[model samples]
Target: HVTLVPSHPSYAVISENKRQVRYQAPIHQPLVKVKYFYGVLGSPSITSGKHYWEVDVSNKRDWILGVCVSLKCNEKWNFLRPENYQPKNGYWVIGLRYANNYCASQDAVKYSDFQDSSRSTPSAPWVVPLFMTIFPNRVGVFLDCEACTVSFFDVTNNGFLIYKFSNCHFSYPVFPYFSPMTCELPMTLCSPSS
Candidate 1:
């Protein structure tokens, strides 16, 4: 089991028990439009080897899960948007939007088909619609520091692979990140079974 680090007091309001967290608006109130709210980091940064953890987001409508290089201090409020949460910004995360759409933090690329004359660019990092029609209540995160890979799993869905980040460059130690978005329900970190 891992402990949550209440790193962003303004962005992430942690519960007293430290098992749950809720997203909070910025205190400074920036003018720039923020697409994605901030989140808190888990304790005991992973510097090497492999680690896995789970989060219970059964009650949340919108949430984000993955890892980040470092948590931003509460004193400094940077107006962060969805585009800024990519690996380049030290964040490797995937999230569920309110509409139940899943997305990852990746560079937008255009895809063209040889037969079709249509060209499309993915606006959000690898946006994928949930075809299974069943959202996972619990999420599993696996990180391999040596392999530079981070993978997410739908624990409630027979441990199905939700998303994966490969060939990642972890310049700094990474910690588990969680965001409940605007949902009032608290996102809890699950304990290992005995």
Candidate 2:
């Protein structure tokens, strides 16, 4: 499963207004990377906490056999420590496409649940919890198992596929996405479409 940590733990508080609601957060850029055994493709497009990339369809779209991505929440993710949460907010989220078409032809692609019971627990069950922090905001994929295809992933809500992985491949595409920034407690996330 993917691990999500807010950019700033405490300061990310949501405020409500009849006409509008605001969630203020200290602005600090997040470091992002996409990784797999195939190797690191490139840095991701950063927007808020979400990232993006394109799998080019120029010449070798069919060579891609499998795909996966890695996300680093931030080192300050430890801010959860004071809150009595596990210290692992960064991890890999792997998505496998066994079928030849693999939803590329379908109007909506659905991924299986993110939790796999067969894998060993990293530290504890409830260490870190947040849909935005864990799953890739969206996953855009284009593939041609025989030729070549460009796949796209958007890790944002309603934007892309959400996946759960059973293993952690932390070598090439792994690094903390954000650095420590002072945060305030008692915060709430604002609904995207609110």
Identify the leading candidate in terms of TM-score. Answer: 1
- Once fitted onto the true fold, the runs of candidate 2 whose alpha carbons sit more than 4 angstroms away are 1-36, 44-50, 56-89, 97-138, 141-194
Candidates in order, TM-scores: namely: 0.79, 0.21
Q: Cα lDDT for residue 187, model 1?
A: 86
lDDT digits (tens) for residues 52-154 of candidate 1: 9889888677888788876432243223566566776677888888746777868555575333448765455545444445688888899999999999888
Q: Residue 181 lDDT in model 2? A: 19
Estimate the lDDT of model 1.
Answer: 0.74
Off by over 4 Å in 1: 24-36, 71-79, 110-130
Q: Relative to the true structure, how large is the alpha-carbon lDDT of every model?
A: 0.74, 0.26
Q: Candidate 2, 189: how far from true, in Å?
A: 31
